[model samples]
Target: MAPALSDILRITSSLLVLMLLMFCMGAINLEAQVGNLAPDEVEALLEVATQLGKRGWNRNMKLCNNTKLPLKPDADNEVVCNCSFPGGTCHVVAIYLKRQDLNGSLPKAIEKLPHLKHLDLWANYLSGNIPPEWANTTLELLSIGVNRLTGKIPGYLGRITTLRSLNIQNNMFSGTVPPELGGLVNLENLTLSANYLTGELPQALTNLNGLKELRLSSNNFTGRIPDFIQRWKQLDTLEIQSGGFTGPIPSSISVLTSLTDLKISNLLGDGSDFPNLESIAGIKYLYLTWNMFTGPIPDWINERDARYGIDLSYNNFTSEAKYRETLNLFKSTWGGNYSKPVEFLIVCSE
Candidate 1:
């Protein structure tokens, strides 16, 4: 009454094929799910990326490997690759790994994401050189400061014209600053202090039309301050201390009307030739210590009153009552405005 033994074998084989078909179909469905995940699914993926762990990268072969999309799909089934936050997509536009236990070099896979804009990996244990591919990407802000990165800074980074801030201070970067950095026209803030950079300050940096803060202190840089820096109208703070700088500070720097804090010391030359102090302008806290400036204190401090606080201590300035100037003075502006001079103190010992 039942099916013959031979027929049973055939039926069993057919059933096996059906099972395989279902397995293959399920795999396809999972793959397609990545491209069709709902809004909530994308948020989960972003959360995973944030937890990249002490290595700061997910290196597992199947790790979120195409199992998820950057953003939720539209009604038309098209998935978005990159969109800012609040759009509710899985797209990883920026990575904030500050003060994390993150270690090791950045993954080369980072360059594959064409829309990456911000990268903050400060205060991490990250070591090794930044990948050269970083130069080709479109980063708006790169903060790798306070890391253990070594090797010459990628000169190619100068090619990134869209960058607004570049902070790589407190690293082991050596060699001269890349003059090629002149190409970054949109640069607003650059902090390369406390490195091993040498050579003269590049005059080409004047080309950075939008530069506002330029810090190159505590390095091995030699030669005089670049006079062309006066062209950077937006520059507010200019610090160049504890270096091998020789020659007088350029008088033209006074033209940077926006300057607020200016420090120029440890010079190998005289500071008197740094222009008649009276001509200098701006609300500046000036420090000209530990130099061979031989002359009387310039009358500028006497003229500008409060806003032009200065520190010429330990220099060769001829002033009898140098200690008397330490007293703060409240001077009245012409418009019945009373302003006090915030005395800037400079201490140097032999």
Candidate 2:
């Protein structure tokens, strides 16, 4: 086989070229499979990690792994980023740092987590305004309630169309209700209770037709209850207590046939005849106390199927007989057993 040196050289040259081509193709495939995280996203998360006291987060720790990270004890617990690996790249899906006693402003860098769906920083000591950068997030549940946060509710939050539940209650946020919130067409549960927020309920809120539970209690909101509230046919639980509303209960509320729990106490107003509630069969809890209502109690209230209870105290109803009749109606309807107590506190001296 030791025939021609030129033939052997040609064959070797062809084999080398083929090997080089194969190596290049393999390198491209590997690059596509194990690509690194986006540089901007990494930078944003690193800023958040640094601002939030680092906790269990470290620059050297793997951001995503096939095995879930173990949750450490309170003092040692990290940011708890739940990540998913798709196409060999790690993507954070949720960040749960609830009750961590975290003390700092929310990092604007949070917008970097494009795949983040749930961000629960509940019961933290985080203060300052919510970062307007959050408007760009595709978050489904944004619960930052029970914090020390202050400043006006950001109007930009309304741009988050994918948001389902937004709980910013128990804070110090103040100012008018942002009309921009009406843009959250997918919102179901909105809790802004126990805050220092003032101003009338925005008319733009009518756009949230899909809302289920709305709590605006313990604020300083003034003005009449909006008539458009009837549009929320899906609403089940509604609480607007301790506001400065100075008008009659809207007759349109009767359209809330799905309503089960309702509280509108300590406002300034007379009651409507509430003609719409006459046929509502699912009502469970009805509270209308500490108001200035000065008419005969509506007879239809006795017709309610309040299996839980009813509270109608501290109002200025004119007749004591009307109160007795109301109590008698409840006793008769519930078979006199009174498994659930009904409150009918009449201020006799007033």
Candidate 3:
């Protein structure tokens, strides 16, 4: 009682069709579970994936497995995206590509990530000028330090109102700092050291009243140190070295009550000329090396807080021994009547 050959083929075909229909239904259910990400955002992310290399983002993996979203799954530990929101919509909030040994130009399409808050590409081989389109975004932190980037800093960067910290140090940027930078009213830290930047520091920089730290050393900037620096009342550290700044240190510097560390060296001025440091009581570390400052060391320097330390090395000071005496005198205050031996460093060399 074996089944006929034609009947067997018909039964087999029906079973196969049923299995196919079940598979399709399961796929549809899976798709429904994965939440929706904006179409434009998906396209922008794909562009990044293509530019950075497809290996960094895998299409086969679940992007938002935890939340079941349509976001691209993390791949090769290179890219990261955030998709947790009220409406199941995802946003690429941060991109950290630091020290990835990445080489090539930064894609201008990066500006397309509207929700991007932090972008770090430090210690890479990235080159070329910063994209002006970046100014149109809402980035909060942009760090591209220790790279091979060149060309003048784009003025459009000033238009980015959301920026809080901008680090572009150790690059090949040339020309004067863009005056437009003053527009970053909320900037906290601005590092532009170790570059070929030149010309007078734009007076507009005084507008950054909220600035905390400013490092502009190892550049070719010339002209007198701007007196407007006193306006940066919140500054804790001010480092300006190896530049061709001339003229006397401004007396207004004493007005910076919040200053803790002041390093200004290798400038064009008489060795005797120094800033008025009497009012800056918070200063703990003062470095003024390799300057032409000659003349008697100010007695007020020793009168500073007992914890204050200074490096006046390789200067044309009147006498090293006298400077040592000043520091030792302050150290004595710590010991009181016992007058215990104390170590004070007053670096002075021929």
Q: Comparing candidate 1 with candidate 2, which one achieves the higher TM-score?
A: 2
RMSD of each: 15.0, 11.4, 11.5
Deviating ranges (above 4 Å) for candidate 2: 1-43, 60-85, 270-276, 303-306, 318-350
Ranking by lDDT: 3, 2, 1
State the C-alpha lDDT per candidate.
0.64, 0.72, 0.73
Better of 2 and 3 by lDDT: 3
**Candidate 3 TM-score, true structure as reference:** 0.75
Q: How displaced is residue 281 in candidate 3, in Å?
A: 1.4
Q: Using TM-score as the measure, which candidate wins? A: 3
Task: Mark the 10 consecutive residues where model 3 has the least summed lDDT.
Answer: 329-338
Cα miss at 88, model 3 (Å)? 2.7
Model 1: how far is 2 from its true place, Å? 82
Q: What lDDT, from 0 to 1, does candidate 2 have?
A: 0.72
Per-prediction backbone clash count: 1, 0, 6
Candidate 2 contains a number of clashing pairs equal to 0
Off by over 4 Å in 1: 1-90, 274-281, 303-309, 320-350
